[model samples]
Target chain A: MLFRLTREDWKVILYNLGRMLHLLSFVFLLPLVPALFYRELDTLSYFFFTSGFTLLLATLLSHLCRTDEQMELKHALCLVALAWLAASLLASLPLWLGGACSSPLDACFESLSGFTGTGLTLTVDPDHLARSLHFHRHLLQFLGDGVGIVAVSLAVLGRTEVSSLLAFRGEAREEGIRPSVVRTTRLIFGIALTFFVVGALMFTLAGIYEGADPGTAFFDGICHSFTGYATGGFSPHSQNLMYYHGLIYEVVAMVLAVVGALNFNLHYALLTGRRREVFRDTEVRVFFFTALLLGALTILLLLGKGIYTSTEALFRRGIFQLLSAQTTTGFSTVPPLHLSLVWPLSLLFLLSLAMLLGGCANSTSGGIKSLRVGILLKSLALELKRPFLPRSVVVGERFHHLKDSPLTPPVVRGAALVATSYLLLFAAGTLITMAYGYTAEQSMFETSSALSNVGLSCGLTHPSMPAGLKLTYMVLMWMGRLEVLTVLVLLIALALSFQRRKAE
Target chain B: MKRTLLCLLLCLSLLPCAGATPVSVEDLVRGPQEWDGRTVTVTGEVVGRLERGGHVWLNLLDNGWPLGIWCTKEQAEGIRVVGDYFHIGDRVEATGVFRARCPEHGGEPDLHAENLRVVLEGRRVPRPVNLLLLALSLLLLGAALSAALTLRFRRKEPFLGYSPESF
Candidate 1:
């Protein structure tokens, strides 16, 4: 089927893909500033080399593929898939060259993890890695899966029909927040930048108050801000948020986590004086109540076990973890080993469920988004009412997002398909993990985390894990981030094109 | 004979005052069951700290597994910096009773230290500026700025068959 593509399709895909590569080249060079500032000359050299090579390759591709052809939906989807894969490979170069990872495959894994905003790490000891490299890892998450690469390109390249299709294919929301895609992209950047600055300042002050030096605090503040606002849970320190060990820092992180996971459309609406939408939006309401419910349940479980001696500990450790998991922000005050080894099974199950039912749709978070969950439940409720209704009774379901929209058949089907896809992906990963001899519960939890892009590990993700399982998780993270459809399209395209070539 | 007895008594007294046998962090984490309730000595760099109710919890990393050492305020004193992005934390030796799951602190695996001593003082990591890389970075920054400016100025052209006015 993919063999039906004309040269024009290839031109459009290559041209846009080249622009993305060029954009990424600029991004790669950004880490050079931190490397030079920290005097990590060795790591600085790798950034220079990789950035230069990418820029050169981008120029070549753009020059060769130069055409006025616009992108079709298939072209856009293929470009997005190829762009992500290429970006992952390019991002791995510096990591491998800097010796942050043990092998090229490990470096690729880290890059994929970062770009997916899944905070899994192959690096055994992050504490000893170069400061610039550590910052780069978090920065990747912010740029790649956080604000999104295609969105950034759209913001720079301006709005077009092709760019709009590309944006949709890139997993950015299709909501017409602004008249132009470019303007909407700019708005997204503006919101993210504003939050980044404010969040950094708050974290810096909190860190300094908690006894960190000004320089250390500022560096950590900015890095943490990027990850926090992106809902990418990487920390410069190996201990994650536990390294800070301050209530104020935890509170700052929590605030950013919640804000990051909120829908951009909601952010725009709220910023533009649509105050009532905050309370009326079904996704927002569902996310808030679900978080509260799970958090309370966690606290109660912790209390029942008499695990934590005081309410402070229960709230800080228990409540914080649940929120972190639900938001799909993997920051944790408690250690992963502790969670795996000592925490009650019920609490673990609750956390896994939270990971599965992630944050709001049209946000950076990954999972079967709360929007879909709310729709599914409403659909279920409508079905339950169908039995009681008399013959010839017309039933119409509606929910409020930006406005009151009918929960039509198409919308319900779309939600169900995506949610079911997520569950199937999670199940597949769980089975693979179990095949590797891991416990069923831990396997399910870890797989849910991977497929949801929640980076919480239950001591299952390690450098020494079975290579096949690691590969499975990388695929899961990729599929989860793209919402599965784009990847499936890319696969079918490749397969059909290859078969056509063989037949010829 | 009395002089010989006095020397022997002094040697015996010195043995009790000596530090406990050092245990690796890996061993402590892997065999917590065997190490539980047993007083042992461990030495590692203190990477993180949490203070509550007159005691401080220290995360000790010894190149292998990280272990937590819970110490009283007095024992935690004199440690100025915890390991982070910019500083190497003080290397400390802790003699404590290991708990695979402590009853007091939410079933966390930790060591309740009776004695803590700094073995090596950690200081600020040196980060001298690199002039060569700084110059290269400035060049790249200039190029990026120019590209951005060019794109901004050339907005009159329709992007991919969609005019801005269409919006």
Candidate 2:
């Protein structure tokens, strides 16, 4: 029921729109770097020209409107939903115009992947493509992911409303470092930049030490750094992670991926010298524990399938895939489809779970998030424990590091909403994929990958994947990136608006 | 027994010369397009290669089909390119363009130059990060939208806290 929001809610939405417009303009500008480098004047001009016009429009619109108000949860969700659709449409301009992506559907998929941090690609020969195009792909992932709510919360117009902030925390961010939203956003950016810059340097060194071409290696370092920190996992190479065959490189990537998946609040805490807080945070603990357990299971499965006879190979490949998928990074050192069918299937399930859990709140990673998953699990456990407790007991349930957490009702509702949307998207993806004559398992895996914004595939993605399936994946990635609630609100709002029009 | 031993000795004697030529990949490429459907010999620097289904797909500079030479995984062992070089400039020959698609599909010979390669295997000058930064910055600056955000509430109140009439 979003019938009437406080006047302040309008202000919040408008402010966010202004921010989104700015974000979109910056995103469009990302492709130009590679375009200029590859000396593809056509692509370069395309990016520059579109970006200029788009920016001019956004600036004009932003200047024409002004408001100072708080945003409720519903309004915030609506803002997120509209922003996703609008940004995706705008992001497709370069691809749609550039001859590189011929079909509108393919362009949408590329844009969706770029925004959602899903690294899947429909391009046949990424290496042969102009350097600008190649860098544009990664640049999209870099910018779209680098700025999380926490990073930019501080940057948005000042003095957020308390009630709105509380509601926003439940849905939008896992942690707010201060009572003020702007401060939180600033802290987020600071931590993200540190990780990004440092991560890039490390990857570059690792690449050089392993005898990689300095130029390619440097570019790869930047792409991987952004992708890893964002947990987006879009690789520049078509072979994904398989192009590189170095032990240290995989290790470096894994570390960065994990760091990306971790909670930004934890980073803030660590940066502030809260060492004990890092250990005590329940989400961080569950995320790593789940990763380790899954990593072990995956290694065993790979070993059983004879994908790797040696323990060392099994450990290396298994750990990398686990981190990649668990973080929803989607990077892989092996051709995942080439793995034993059973193993890939299992890995897919684990990855799906990870994607569903997502990374920590207020970070670049998409999906439901580990913190929410942890809360859901705790809530479920409490329900089970209720019967054993005395009638007088208050239960006093608490999970660590979460302030103002939801009780059973809200948490259950949130989880169900997320689950329902995810399943629907996955189902839609499968149905469309089946039309392309993809096998059931392949369809399921590919859809799950797209919907989760986890780009692992079972040989189904290609330029030839039916336009319908491609579009479906685009919708899934868009929804996955924003989480389902925002999209659902948008859908419901549209439906209601149409009904009202009919009634009149 | 004597006849069998003599036959084995004759077959063994030819093995050394066979080893010397090493079944050149170049031989596979120049043989014939008619033989394209079958395995032939070709060798060049391994470049712009992608491996799938136990076959390694690569391009030779001289071929025009752009149809990749497909070699079994076993056949591709020990082959390596020194730099970021792939199909564009590597000098090794290839023998596997026999699988080239019919020209009707715009499929010419499987040999196509890759962006990474150059003649004599030299690399094109790489773009510096400053250049990259400038390009990316320019793109970002151009694409940004500065629209004022708008919030339109749903027409019907689905919960107790909100009401359509209140709007």
- Give the top-scoring candidate (TM-score): 1
Candidate 1 residue-wise lDDT, A1-504, digit = tens: 134556677788787777777778878878978877876765676777677767766655766787777666788777777777888889998888777888888888888888888887787677777878888898988887678877667557633655754655466365656777777777888888899999999999998876566776798899899888888888887778766667788899999999989999989988989888899999999999999899888988887886676666776688888888888888877767667666788888999999999999888788899999999999999999999999799998999988899999999999999998998998889889999999888998889888888888888888888788888998998888888888887888777767777888
Q: Each candidate's chain B TM-score? A: 0.77, 0.34
The deviation in Å at residue A165 for candidate 1 is: 4.3
Q: Per-prediction count of colliding residue pairs?
A: 1, 50
lDDT of 1 at B152: 31
Tell me the whole-model lDDT of each prediction, alpha carbons only.
0.80, 0.60
Clashing pairs in 1: A307-B106
Candidate 1 residue spans exceeding 4 A from truth: A1-3, A158-161, B1-23, B27-38, B48-58, B68-90, B97-112, B120-167
Q: Residue A426 in candidate 1 has what lDDT?
A: 85
Q: For candidate 1, write residues B96-165 as lDDT tens digits.
A: 7887666665445678887788989988876554567646755654554445334434554343334556
On the 0 to 100 scale, the lDDT of residue A137 in model 1 is: 91
- Per-candidate iRMSD: 5.5, 12.7
Q: Give the per-residue Cα lDDT of candidate 1 at A308.
A: 70
